[model samples]
Target: MDEKRSVRISKTLSRVLRHDPASIGITLDEAGWVPVQTLLTALGRKGTRITRDELDHVVAVNNKKRFAYSEDGSAIRASQGHSVAVDLGLAAAVPPAVLYHGTTGAHLDAIFREGLRPMSRQDVHLSADTETAVRVGSRHGRPVVLTVDAAALHAAGHEFRISANGVWLTDAVPPGHLGRLAR
Candidate 1:
C-alpha cells in the first residue's frame, strides 16, 4: 500500500480501538474488531478495497508491529491504542490524589480536558465512588472514590488526574486503598 493509504489505515484502526468510531464520525463495531463489511464501507467511502489477497497483504505487512492479529487471522487490532500509544503510555506517572468528575455528562469533557490527560492514567482510572476511589472519579459535584495511595502513582509521585465517570486515571490502584486513604 502507498504511504498515504497506510497512514490512513493506521489512523482508522486507532480510532476504532480508542474512541468510539460513532463519536468521531465513523460507525463500526465487529465484536471487539471492526467487521470486514464495516471496513469495506469505510474503504468505499475512501474509494478503496481489498481483494482478500490485499487484505492478507495489509495484515501481513503490519502485523505485530503496528497491529495485532486474531487467532484465526480474520481480525486485527492496533498494537497498543494508536500511533502515539507508546509515547502516551511511557510518560511520567501520576501521583495518588483525589480525582473529580461530573455527575452529569455535560461536564465530562471539562473533566477529561482539565483532569485526565494532564494527569497520569496510571494514577487514576475513573470511578463512581467519592471519598473512596479518588484517583478515578471526578470533581464536578459527583460522588467518587479517592484512591489514597495508588502504588503505581505512589512509586511515580503525586501527579495525577480523574476520569470522566469519577474514576482515578491510574494504571492500577493497590488493593488496600480504602485503608491507606483512611490514614
Candidate 2:
C-alpha cells in the first residue's frame, strides 16, 4: 500500500487497539489483545478492508513498531500508548540514568509545578534519546526537551517499564526529578 493509505490504516488500528475497540464492535482483553480474525472482521464491517498480508506489512514496517502480534500469531495489540484502561502487561524494568520527555515550551510552567502526569493516558511516555523527544515535542509546538533523573526516581521506588517499541512508561515524573535541558 502507499504511504498515505498505510498511515490511515495504522491510525485506525491505533484508535481501535488503544482507545476504543467498542467503536469497532470489539473488545481488548485485560492484556489489551484482541483476536486477529475478530479484528479483521470488525474492520470489514466498519468499511476498512485490510487483508492479512497488508496487516502484516503494517505491523512489520511501521516506523515506531506500534503494533505487536501475540506469540501464536492469533492476536494483536498496540505495544503501548493506550488511553483506555487495559493493562499492557509490561514488567517493571530499570531505566537508564536519564530519560527525556518532549513537549511544547508553553507547558513548562505547569510542568515545573505539577510534574509530568499522564494527563489522559495511562502513563507518562518518555524517550531514551533527546532527538526522539524533540521529534515528539514538535508535534505539539515549539519543542522543549526535559531531562529526567531516572536512576534517582527508580531509587526512590518509582517503577519504570520499557514498552515493546522502546518508549519508557511510568506513572508520573515529579518536578523534583525533572530538569530543563539546555538547547
Candidate 3:
C-alpha cells in the first residue's frame, strides 16, 4: 500500500473503532471487530480494492492497540467499545452507599438508578448482586447498591422470595437510594 493509502485505512479504522461509522455518514457495522465486508465496501467506494488477505494483514500490522478479533473470529470489537466492566464484590457484607462510576460525561449513572425498564424487555438485565450491580452501574458512570440486606432481608421487613435458581430475590427501594448494610 502507498503512504496515502495506508493513511486512509488508518484513519478509517480509528473512526470505525472509536465511534459508530454510521454517525458520520459512513455506513459500517462493527462486525465483532471490524466488518470485513464493510471495510472492503468503504475502501472500494473510495477507489481502493482490499482483499481478505489485506484485511488480515492490516489487522495484524496495525499497532495502535484498539482492535481485537473475537475468539471465534466471527467479528471484531474495539477495546473502547461502549462500556467498562467491573466486579464490585466486597468480600464481607459491608455494602456501599453509592457506587462511584466513571468521571464526567459518563451517562451510565442514570441507567443504574432508573433501571433498564424504560428501554425494553430485552434490555432489562438488572444486576444480580452488589458486584454485578456496581459493574452494570459503572458502565454508565454510576454505581448501584443493594436495596436490602443480603443476609437478612426478612428481618428487615422484606418478604423473602426466590428466583434465579433459589439464590436471590427482587425487591424495590427508593429511587437513587443506596443501602450500606452490615454483614
lDDT of each: 0.43, 0.95, 0.42
Ranking by TM-score: 2, 1, 3
lDDT of 1 by residue, 67-161 (tens): 55567766555433332222232334353343322233463444434443323222334433453434223444433323333454455454444
Superior by lDDT: candidate 1 or candidate 3: 1
Alpha-carbon lDDT of model 1 = 0.43
lDDT of 2 by residue, 136-177 (tens): 999999999999999999999999999999999999999999
How far in Å is the alpha carbon of 161 misplaced in model 3? 34
Q: What is the TM-score of each candidate against the true structure?
A: 0.36, 0.98, 0.35
Which is the better candidate, 2 or 3, if ranked by lDDT? 2
Comparing candidate 1 with candidate 2, which one achieves the higher lDDT?
2
**Over the full model, what C-alpha lDDT does candidate 2 score relative to the true structure?**
0.95
| Model 1 quality (TM-score) | 0.36
Candidate with better TM-score, 2 vs 3: 2
In candidate 3, stretches whose alpha carbon ends up further than 4 angstroms from where it belongs are 1-4, 23-34, 46-48, 81-183
